[model samples]
Target chain A: MSLQHALLGVLEARPMSGYDLVQFFDSSTAWIWAAPQSQIYPTLRRMERAGLITGDDEPRGPKLTRTVYSVTDQGREELERWLSTPHDPSPPRDPFLVQALNFDTIDAEKAHAVLEQFITEQEKAAAEAEAHRQRLLNKDTMLLKERLTRRDPAEHDRIARLKAHVFAGVAAVARTRAEWAREGQRLLTED
Target chain B: MSLQHALLGVLEARPMSGYDLVQFFDSSTAWIWAAPQSQIYPTLRRMERAGLITGDDEPRGPKLTRTVYSVTDQGREELERWLSTPHDPSPPRDPFLVQALNFDTIDAEKAHAVLEQFITEQEKAAAEAEAHRQRLLNKDTMLLKERLTRRDPAEHDRIARLKAHVFAGVAAVARTRAEWAREGQRLLTED
Candidate 1:
């Protein structure tokens, strides 16, 4: 559902073919919402059936017809409703944490390797999110610039910051998990 | 697959019926790994079929029967392998963050309400994780005590701390998000 809403928000900026939409998600917006083309295509069809979006086949070249999608009035309304409505908090599904929790079952050397790898993974994630957050804030990304044009000039600052908030949250969570991995490593005691 | 390993970890401590396993998950362990009876039952059967576990029908009452599950030697090896293996980092799929990212499409008043609700939900989650982290440290939970008995007396403290590490990570992430929500509200700026 969120993926559909995310796709609508992107298409709301400007109409795009499914190929462009896939590229958009894969590039600038993948940090917040990453959907494979397999999921994206099927969901797009469902959204069209639901009358939230419209898709029309347009000729790209001699051999290919690309289906371009645009958010309908209903889609805009749906996106607004989704943005305003409070969302259910994501439930805890930390498989990595569960793995760490069972660290007592493994030897100290193996546990050390696991904890060190976890730290590396979290640090890498924190770095990626922080970099993307800066891109949005600087309006360096093409999509953010595109999104800004649709908003009033006076409102553009707030719009970019709103999206940047999501990345900041991602970075903060990754950093915290990295620190917690350190805490878990300390508990080993080597006895 | 992690759920299967988590279930193995718990059953490794002591044999339990599916009903008891479900209740255990609903209570002490839900904070880390939660699976509804629907998922647990099927996965347990699948594990049995795979020779990772064995379930034997036991007499419950007059003309009544219950199945109790025990981890096999193969299951213990599987759990050990999983504990030692590095887990893939969970990809970011924050629907709430996705909702916030599109807040530019909503009114300020509605955005304020959404942010406030998120703060409240995150605060409640932080409090729950902190409480459970304390329970693990104090050995207040029956499950932790049972788990400890299965380990060497010398290793009990480290074992408990390993589990508590997961809850601590959960609490830290929740606290960070609550703070991020505050940062987001400051961006509204009302100009």
Candidate 2:
């Protein structure tokens, strides 16, 4: 999604400063859709100009003023409208697969080396993904336990199950990529 | 990897016209890195100007006068240098995750509907991946059987095992995602 849409979504949740939006993106959706702080602030300004969102509620700071943004009626209408539109998948843009396709051009030895390198990168990435997935799982578990304590046992179970499924999907993908790497290494060594 | 390095790596194997590079990228490396033909042809001309690659001995045709490219010594050195460098992971850019992160902000029912839509999309993607994995498996199986017939089984075991592992990994991931979709449907219905 565009940074604009992300910012708008955050504002729809609650009136948040640009800094808050940045923080939300980093801690919550960092793994899936991340944008730089640089992009966030500018998009906030642009959205304000377009009247999609506004920041009339400014929290005062001794040194600088922090603007808290809320979705205007127009903004909510836009988000509701955007939500109805079909979401198309972005075409894949993987470099490794590109190399693999034309691999016939390179000699076996050279292609093998590239494949080895690809495996190494995939391993590292899988490790990081696993770590992130674990952290999210822990957080989800804690949140569910808290909800259970508050007598909302149903909500706890509901969110926990959803969280589990999402992270399970992520973990599975990482595991698969790692397996692919090991297979790639074996192929390179043999031929 | 930059488009420049990827292009050089392809040429290092054998000289190819820009058109061929574009086609190769679509078929193979489209998974990793992708560049349009517009980007590929211009980059080739720029690489030529930079003395990284030179033209081939023969031209294919007048209109289709393919400009064959081979890596120069400088290009080879550059590609090798790139190979030695550590890789950086391209961050995931999934819009659905962005939307989900703010699910509490919007109408819960609407968000649930959006997620249901994503499940359908993920199912389609998983199906495509599974199909491709099966194709790879079938092709490798055929080649392995052919090798057995010829009694030249030296690399057969290695190739077969590697291909099998990679396909298994792919199928596993796809299955997990499909499972997630089923479990997720239950969670969405709970609220």
Candidate 3:
């Protein structure tokens, strides 16, 4: 369902085809909402069927045709509804944390290995989110530039700041996980 | 599924009826793994069918028959496998952050309202987790005490510590979210 809203949100920013949407998702902004090509096409189809979006076929070459997707008026209304609506925070269901809860079953070496693995994973995620946040702040993004043109010039910087802030929140979360892993490691040593 | 592993994790510590398991999840530890009774019954059925658990009919009274569940040797093996395995980090799909990514569409007051609501939610989560962590550390929890009795006396403190650490981690994550919400609220004011 979020994938649907995110798709509509992106289309509202700038209309693009499924291929371009895939490229858009693969870009630095992918950190915001990551969806695979497989998910993208099926969801776009569903959105089109629901009348939230529309697809127009155009000839890219003499023999090639591509469908460009854009948000319908209904899509914009849905987008606004989503923006104003309160979203429920998802419950945490981390398998690693579940494993950590049972660290008493394993030795310090094995448990330490588990915590270390978690550290690496969290650090990698934090690094990616942090890097993306930096790129967003520097205004070095292509897709965001396109999005900026859709709004007033006075609103451009805040838009970019909003995106950077979101990614920074992502980085902050990953950092907390890494810190938690380290704290778990420390507890193991005390045992 | 993590739910299966969590169920096994609980039963391995102490076996209980489906009703009792439902009560257990509703306890303070509910913060760790939140599964509804609907999900619990169906998942128990599936796990029983898979031979990971066994259900025995125990008569409580003249008219009441309860199916008590316990983990099998196979379930223990699966739990061990899960503990040692490095679970992949799930991708972030936060709807609030997704909304923040599109805040440029809404006014400052509206966006501030969004961030403010998120702050209240995060703060509530943080407080709950913190209280649970304190309960866990003081050895004042009913479930953890039962779980501790299953292990050697020498290992009891460490086991409690492990549970406390997990809840602390949860509290830390919630605090980060609340802080992030505050940051978003600040950004809205800056606009």
In terms of DockQ, the best-performing candidate is: 1
User: Between prediction 1 and prediction 2, which has the larger DockQ?
Assistant: 1
Each model's iRMS: 1.6, 4.6, 1.5
TM-score of chain B of each: 0.94, 0.65, 0.94
Give Cα-based local distance difference scores for all models.
0.85, 0.62, 0.83
DockQ of 2: 0.31
State the lDDT of candidate 3 residue by residue for A34-100, as single tens digits.
7889999999999999999999998999999999999999999988888887777766667666788
Which sequence of candidate numbers ranks them by lDDT, best first?
1, 3, 2
Per-prediction backbone clash count: 0, 11, 0
**Comparison by lDDT, 2 against 3, better one:** 3
Top-down TM-score ranking: 1, 3, 2
Poorly placed runs, candidate 1 (over 4 Å): none
Question: lDDT by residue for model 1 over B1-191, one digit each (tens)?
Answer: 78899899889888889999999889867767777889899999999999999998999998999999999999999999998988777767779878888877888888888999999998988899899989988877888888777778987777777777788888888899999988888776555
Model 3's chain A TM-score stands at: 0.93
Candidates sorted on DockQ, descending: 1, 3, 2
Tell me the DockQ of each model, to 2 decimals: 0.76, 0.31, 0.67
